[model samples]
Target: MSENLWEHRPESGYVTGTDLAGYRVEAIDGHIGKVDKHTAEADGANIIVDTGVWIFGKEILLPAGCISAVDHPNGTVFLNRTKEDVKGAPEFHRDHHTEAPDYRLTLGDYYSGRVL
Candidate 1:
């Protein structure tokens, strides 16, 4: 598979919709948090998880391509990554980072590096 979905879009198997918010997010090791927001655009898609109290209310964005599956019956979104991997991701700043020029590139690089 391609390292990054932005480079070569593929079947990510992630169910996308506006109802994804509030869904529980699960890493390989354990539960991380809940989906605070999501975007399902033609160019790309991702979920912003609000890790309240876990990491001081930090929010992390995970590419939709990284999603392994969605268990609607259980209201959980499963990821192909581990907790440590997500923890090491670049901190998401809803204010200025979203408009930063390097935001997309940084996310691509960080996720691509973990594909192996």
Candidate 2:
């Protein structure tokens, strides 16, 4: 796990694999709508932003690179963007969003096709 995803460092590199159940990824300064689930690639090198348990919910994507750091004491996963930025980026949709063009432009470039 450690070898795959790099740990979130301010002036350093990426963060490593996260403790899936013990983390709460936030939109820098936004309210959390419960984390629905996580999907890891690179054999767990990175995780995908799942959907929220609430209705009118949409799926999200979190690249390991975007992770700023992990706060072990509170079990929180920190992201490096504001709420507006996150929502505006590309709202994840299971069907349409996963299409070829969408993947290449949005998530594919974001992830660099690698988990980390």
Candidate 3:
């Protein structure tokens, strides 16, 4: 697995507020989805993507660490990972793993291939 893209990095000026909802998310290869919601907490930030009809209506949460850039003008969130990487990630269960720190750890481990 690859390392967390934003590890040890401070929030870039491009990383705006939760107002990013509805912005299209672009993977390294191509478009993935739009931001359904976003949350910024003490630990980190995350974005809930709504892949409308792209993968049978699948929605996934991506850690802010995965973000490589934010193009507010274009209404897009660029990710460091490819679409395949995000597709193979552990499925997101609404309200089940959102608040679970252990679940997040597992997800972080899954992405970086290291215990977090």
Candidate 4:
């Protein structure tokens, strides 16, 4: 995983404090879902996408580094990953997601192209 996996890329156009909730999240191939929640923490930035109906109401947590761009005008957040990649990610456990170090490491590894 990138050392900066939790930090937003400078070229992603993600302005700090920007409200990303409700913004559409698009994978490399197609649309995935909307942002259910997010954080702009300097080191732990991430977004929780609620994949309504598309994945049977699954929610996935993506590190900021996965974002390729943020089109504020269009209300879309584009990701470098594909739908299959996102779908194959570690199951999101809401209760432990935010505070678990293991979860973060696993997610980081997944996004870094390491076999899970």
The backbone clash count of each candidate, in order, is 0, 8, 0, 0
Question: What is the per-residue lDDT of model 3 for residues 1-116, given as tens digits with 9 covering 90 to 100?
Answer: 12443241254335544467889999889999999988865455678899888777988988877877787788888887888888988888868977777778877866675222
**Per-residue CA lDDT of candidate 4, range 7-56, in tens?**
99888998888989999999999999999998888778999999999899
lDDT digits (tens) for residues 4-105 of candidate 1: 444213454454454678889999899899999877775456778998887888998877766777777677888878998999999888786654558877
Candidate 4 lDDT score relative to the true structure: 0.89
By TM-score rank, best first, the candidates go 4, 1, 3, 2
- The C-alpha TM-scores of every prediction are 0.83, 0.56, 0.83, 0.93
Reference-based lDDT, each prediction: 0.75, 0.49, 0.75, 0.89
Candidate 3: which pairs clash?
A: none
Best by TM-score: 4
Better of 1 and 4 by TM-score: 4
Tell me which residue pairs clash in candidate 4: none
Ranking of all candidate structures by their lDDT, best first:
4, 1, 3, 2
Residue 27, candidate 4: C-alpha displacement in angstroms: 0.1
Clashes of 4: 0
Which consecutive 10 residues in model 4 have the weakest lDDT in total? 107-116
